[model samples]
Target: MAKLPEGILGPVSGTIGSIVGAKWRGVYYIRSKGKKRKKTRSKKQLASQAKFKFLQEFLKPFRPYFIVGFQNEALYCSEWNSAFSANYKAVTGQSPDFAIDYTLVKLSSGLQPGLRDPNVRYAARNKVEMTWTFQDEPMVTYDDQITMVIYCAEMNKAQGSIGGVSRADGKFVFKLNPRIAGKELDIFIYVSSLNRKLISPTHYLGKLIYASTTKP
Candidate 1:
């Protein structure tokens, strides 16, 4: 068979391990239940919890992305890295390319005015969107065209019910104009805060995004 894509391996292993472990744990608990043992949470439940805990721990390295008000929230991986590299180049007069990773989380909730009934379940659900941006020095090119590619490392969305919450997972790609001497170039990603009132003014979170450049 052809080789599987490298990205498929991690998710596949996680899924298979979770399924097999849950089944095995469940079987063990069922067998124990017949021995008149004290009632206890099933092995499956425990294993699931353990799995989640393990995943959470594994994901801890990315926690910086979730913290509110992190700088560079609007930048995606490429933009953030590129900007950083470009800034370094601008300041040092040497081009150095690097990469950064980031993640975004958004939550929204609200209450709506009731029309006919004074008290009713008529509150409009809130929505949220997160955006990232990268501002960098301009680039020079002999050709007239530039191309950018965006790849999403991972994305997850949880739909809300009464709150009308929804999540989106994907990467965005855009080609920027060559950097000009006086003009600044920027890349932006954003999540809309629909129906949700902000606790503070909507300033850039500045954390959940990163960027890198392909060229040295």
Candidate 2:
């Protein structure tokens, strides 16, 4: 029960006599030597970092689910890489590391489904019509679910249509505020399989200037 210097008011019971314990800010704290981070990374750590960075952007459309407090970058990367390796081995019968980049693209890309040319137009009061036909998936199953990521250039933010392809005719309609007319709007299309077991690479549809105005 001896008091120590620098506000450390408790006895350290551990074998390491070099360290000291203290109670600060209503919490018990311990002081220890600090270690520096390694500049070089192992292959597995590098791979984990790569997948983590890709997932940050790839899962942007579904931020809350993949990036919740329950998960961390390092662990998440490891989990995703492990999952990818297992799936790749099952599908192509090859070492997963050999095609990590290719696999990353396949998993992150939103338009990999190879949808035909997309058409976008201003429809009536404050709605826009988007239509596109699908192309057959050559090596694997085709993706049927669609997501339209709308990048409002002026706002520097994005809004996505979760069920952009729920319509029966492969058409998507969304209402926009006329106040945003004349501003630039960028669109991206992403498709996933019905079961969502697969997601395609993203396809960039040219920028569309909102034309409808409430005043006119």
Candidate 3:
């Protein structure tokens, strides 16, 4: 075929086709966009990505805790691990590379021992004491530190977190201020381990209003 004159070619100067100039074998040539790659995805893949996106929204506030849990390798062989493996394979056509992807980390981090919420009790002196025990796997790890936080809903202010108790016992007592003693207080508890490299995840126990003891 005789070489076309150098310049824009027919029907090749827009989104579909742009007959720009090119040199080939000491000759100028016009070219158009090549066939698209034809990207495709399976229903499972779409489902997997959709699940991931949803999980990102659900776990945004808890990211710090989730990363820590993921780093500690806590999700092994759990329901989450199995579910993730299935869903991710459906999307990626293979097992996870486990390269610490952010979404994966967050999802895995949020999953821990779903221990029943600890029983919170009003103690002897405007203090809150929490008691809980794991039936199967222990929720409290050796290096874990338990912390309790209190907030007054009516005041819309956090009394703040206190009581860095050891996880070995799975129980902690935190005192409330006199000013907010009779007021209802929301309570939250989370566990943190000694590892500084990973971000910690918080597992809230429950909430309660603080009051002085009715008895010893």
Candidate 4:
């Protein structure tokens, strides 16, 4: 019997060299120990040979399993991308004329399935706004501005409903008839989780605004 490493003790030899040099069956035979030649084979040597053979058989099926797992992961990623794009379109109403901006924030704690349970939560938000001044005359109406804002909010709500219990907020502002005093109009649309607290503003994924208007 060969001395095993610390924390490992068994009738079987610990080192591969010990197992290969073991002699019980014809598989392995001891060379020579001290002056005496130990030729008898131990029962432990036969068990070791059986263990090695079992390991060879067990690993044969692992390759295909790993391949299938990779394929499933790829499919999942594709579906997630499609869903995200669709949601963005639905919320914005107008298809993005420019490149979409995206920010991802990871939750500190993992989330649970229930409504209120706080776990790992991730959020993505988008904003799109534009303002133009006509040198000739302003043709856009207050009703048009209100309608656009309402449409945007409705779309955002629909997106939030589909994407779990999340929050969506949007605002549209227009300076209608700036020639007239106190004629400006503004609209806001905001949504949030009913159960969990809203993500902190300091969080990396907190809030972002992107629009055709001047950035501040």
Candidate 5:
């Protein structure tokens, strides 16, 4: 299945027989494929695998945000993978029970200026409000967009805004999904440029208990 771009004379790609062809940093090369090995997992290896699997599933819901949130840090890897690498240790706990620490989770990373004196509150049943001021920084712009991630662990669901509000607005009113009412919500916010070329470090806004009409 190897492809010869120059009609059997140029560089090749893909796999052919026992050899695999690929390009790295512009140079084409071929290497014999290594045979797959089966090995029993040690305690340490099992813990690491557990963390990897747990984090992957936890971050799946945030895939859309990672595309722009980790764009600057992606480098040779994908945006999602870059985010996973950066947050692997920060959000994942130790062995025996590698639980995810929601407060330590980061949704974005970059050089963009973040909100000044930001605050969030469960304004009412099914409504949340966020307020912030623009910082006096050279890179700060009125057109910079605000992004938010509101997660409800009770229902294992998340919802948010992406580049839907401007930094100049100073306040945003996010209407929660009706189903999430009464659940505790963890909130995170960050700023990004319209084109997503620049992003700010994610800020954790603590948790809010969405009020419900029904009695506990």
Candidate 6:
């Protein structure tokens, strides 16, 4: 039995043939009332699930950066989802083993000009310093905020800054966590507008061992 609250042409509620009609979260939906059969997942399906799960865990630490880095691409989806969808193929491996290729990872995307002659080095006292030259492109401003992301898989940690530096500054420095010391870390950097409407593609600063000897 189905009832059309708004009339015969409107949405119906209750069972209609093999489906049941209902409203949930203010949205009307129809679904089959028949019991669903249990089906074993294929190898490909299982592999895909593993790949997605792996990527999700790997990307979890970068959520803060993704909020602004992937904002432009988040018109329909969340910033995190936008980042995942954009880099899924580039970061994941093929077929059975979906190993992540960190070098191929991209953290942000936009037409904003990216860093030129970017460089990173370990300074005294466990501090990491990054420097770059800004490209002379239209709409590129000196106030564009700089964002850095660092990941150390061996220590299962990620750290970075989202803003506070600008393109005109050309350099930024931050101290590393002692826990991740002496570990090989992957570093990435990009620039985004103050309002976060624009962003530059992420630049991989390559892997570097944080062999800092100083304590504190």
What local distance difference test score does each model get? 0.24, 0.50, 0.48, 0.25, 0.84, 0.81
lDDT digits (tens) for residues 34-134 of candidate 2:
55786898877876666555444433443322222112222324434433433342232122333222222222333335457778765644566788765
TM-score of 1: 0.20
Number of the top lDDT candidate: 5
TM-score for all predictions? 0.20, 0.47, 0.41, 0.14, 0.87, 0.78
lDDT by residue for model 1 (11-127), tens: 222123223211231231111222445778797776555544433433343232222212233233332333333222222111122222222222111121111111111111121
Judging by TM-score, tell me the better candidate of 2 and 6.
6
Lowest summed lDDT window (length 10), candidate 2:
65-74
Candidate 2 residue 118 Cα shift, in angstroms, is: 1.2
Candidate 3 structure quality by residue, lDDT tens digits, 1-216: 233443445222234234455554354445664766667978778766666764434334333333334444543343444334433422322223222222222222333333345777777557777777643454435545554556564554445442256555666767777766667765655555545332234444445644454453
Better of 4 and 5 by TM-score: 5
Please list the residue runs of candidate 1 whose C-alpha ends up more than 4 Å from where it truly belongs after superposition: 1-40, 69-214
Model 6, stretches more than 4 Å misplaced? 1-37, 92-97, 211-216
Report how far off residue 64 is in candidate 5 (Å): 0.9
Q: Write model 6 residue lDDT over 1-216, tens digit each, in one string.
A: 988999988887999889899886467778889877599989888888888887887888888887778878876557888888877876556655566677667788898887789998776446778988877778789899999988888765789999899988988987788877556788999888888878898888888765556434
Q: TM-score of the candidate numbered 3? A: 0.41
Error of 2 at 174 (Å): 1.1
**Where in model 2 is the C-alpha error above 4 Å?**
1-107, 110-112, 136-143, 164-168, 177-182, 212-216
How far is 204's C-alpha from truth in model 4 (Å)? 35
- Tell me which residue pairs clash in candidate 5: none
Q: How does residue 49 of candidate 2 score in lDDT?
A: 68
Pairs in clash, predicted candidate 4: 23-41, 24-41, 109-119, 109-120, 110-119, 110-120, 111-119, 111-120
Estimate the overall C-alpha local distance difference test score of candidate 5. Answer: 0.84
